[model samples]
Target chain A: MKTLLDLLMLSCKKASELIDKQLLLNLSLKERLMLKIHTRLCEACFEYEKQSKLLDKLLLKHISTSEESQIPIQINIELKQKIIHNINPKK
Target chain B: MLNEMDTNNPATTITSWVKLYSDNLFSWALHKTSDREIAEDLVQDTFLVAVNSFDKFEGKSNPKSWLFAILNNKINDHYRSNFRHQTTNNTISLDEYFDANEHWRPEETPQPWLVESSHILDNPEFTKQFEECMQRLPQHWFSAIHLKYIEERKGVAICQEIGITPTNFWQILHRAKLQLRKCLETHWFKI
Candidate 1:
């Protein structure tokens, strides 16, 4: 039988993983039980779960949408030429 | 012009890969090193290595993965070669820095102070703070986090690329997150 502390740590890890997943999802049975037991006894992990969810929202907001631009035309041409020449030495 | 290439030529395939992946690879390297010059050199080195070993690439994996594997080895080599000279300048005393008793506990009824995502682009300080927090992480942990999170690679794929077990990968990520949160709390959120 896992100790309460062990169960709490597992719950914390699962809670963090869930933050990146779909919102308002139900926890796994084990996770739900761990949460019920731990949150009833330990206020810190409860607050942590809340804060982790909030942080996930903030992270999604800050994710960069900028698509990577192309390599400069000159370098692309030069590299292409080099590779072509390497493939066919007499090119 | 690359348009003149015969469709079956290996050169064409190589050039296509370069065209497709160079910018992404360069950006990845730049973010990792935080030095544009070094990043460019690393990118060039990656291509050179790929080209020289082109025959070894049996198309078993995607071109991007192959190139990244080469680049990872190059980066590791660069670090190993420079570690001695780099470590001489600023030595941290571990005993003075780490305290087992200084454990962190989350606040009770934590006030939500989430920054809006729209502000990240405009706020240079936030980006700087993020980069600083990233830099404080151990190199392996930092690499694991960047490859997994920023690159958006799945755990199994990242494990394949980095040659680490899934358990080790999770451990690295856990440590990295814990350190980043601690750094952020101390550097940005302390009131």
Candidate 2:
């Protein structure tokens, strides 16, 4: 059983890599199969994947909030002044 | 969103646009470069280009989108000149997390975050620490995170734009995420 499992299984490290790739892109059929086998067989890799997904969620919220006004980004008056200065028609 | 673009006196309303759009532009630029001064400069340059080509604007398109388009171009150019030339080191440090048999080391395994509320973003301290963790990542990694997460761009396109191959991009994100998870666990989760 160990030998058969080894034949199809990905190590947790490789499985984790595949998990992250799955978050961003579609894995090839073989990779998808292997990741499925490994995660089903190895419980730790499955938990890692869950945590990774959670991290992605948190990161999106973190950045989107920053994108919005959650982070105090002061609009500098000088930035407006400098831009107006540049566009001014120099006689 | 209406630009109020009068071809008659194209330059007149730029001052208003400058005030209206600088914050959004600077915010985006800051996200891209993670530098306040550079974000400021990019905002300044974006307004200059917008003013120069004001007649072309036509006021038909959403002014915010139009200005954002210009700012995005400036950001692309910024990355092209600054980062595209630098070689991306594809060496991913996996041994730190894996043992000889490629199993996760006991200490390096992923533990539960124990997050109770989905509204964790409401916690300013957690979000602040989250930004600190992100700031800890290298510039290229930050750019990768931004493009992948915030922009939701494809992996191949992100790799192409960042001058890294697809596999290299994969490895960078993997390692960068590993660091982030560890940092967050240490700092926020305490698990």
Candidate 3:
């Protein structure tokens, strides 16, 4: 007794959630169809999916780039001394 | 270095390992978590556990890998405990984004963000802004996003390790991304 509207209609809120879900897992056939329908009818959700994907892409790139550059971190000499002291005790 | 070192002396052996590995572990922990204090604490805890299990860990795995595995477990526990300890204060209402009918509110609706610069993330200032926005996220949400994007971990793997349901994971990501999107728009794009 499921109608096409019932199967395919999703509010932007739900559609956005499905968009995020699709990133981590494949949406069900109904979920996919509903997402497709909703994004078609909703420009905001369409922009949202695009922006969300872009954000992930940028964040990933930033992470790798920052790591490669090493963020100019100074080795924590104090923490090192502390660890050595803690582990060597009563040995 | 290890061949000449005294394996019988736990103190000397662990001290050498600490001197070698602590810096690498700290940088990694810092990357995974942007907090310096937490990163240092995790490294401290990782070594403490390593000392307790040093005999058990003997001759089984490479020291580097063994230490990393322990650190990873600590990181997972960090995420799990943060998620478990979360109260209503940690959650932001979904009503801010959607209307009573569950459609996007006019003000909260997503807008196109022009990402024309392929080298966008290369900009030092933008990267700073990005990190700041990520810092605004709840601890659990930040961990989820970090696992998914920075570590490129699988959803199922993250859910299994972090002990959160897939449905809840997606919902958190949805909300997290919305905040990120809005933050970047206001700070980077609009600027």
Return the interface RMSD of model 3.
Answer: 2.8
Candidate 2 lDDT, B22-56, residue by residue in tens = 77778777765678888899998888788788888
lDDT at residue B39 of model 1 (Cα atoms): 72
Each candidate's interface RMSD = 7.5, 2.9, 2.8
Q: Write the per-residue lDDT of candidate 1 for residues A1-91, one digit (tens) a residue.
A: 8876774554434444333222323457776665566555545446555655444333333332233342222233444444445545565
Per-residue accuracy of model 3 over A14-88 as CA lDDT, tens digit each? 888888888678888988888888888888989988888888788777653345235645488999989998988
lDDT of each: 0.54, 0.76, 0.79
Where model 1 places Cα greater than 4 Å from the true spot, the runs are A1-28, A36-43, A50-66, A69-91, B1-28, B35-38, B46-114, B117-122, B150-153, B160-163
Better of 1 and 3 by lDDT: 3
Error of 3 at B7 (Å): 1.3
Query: Which consecutive 10 residues in model 3 chain B have the weakest lDDT in total?
Result: B83-92
Report the C-alpha lDDT of model 2 over A1-91, residue by residue, as the tens digit. 4796678889898899998887557899989899889888787888788878888888776654344444466667787777777777572
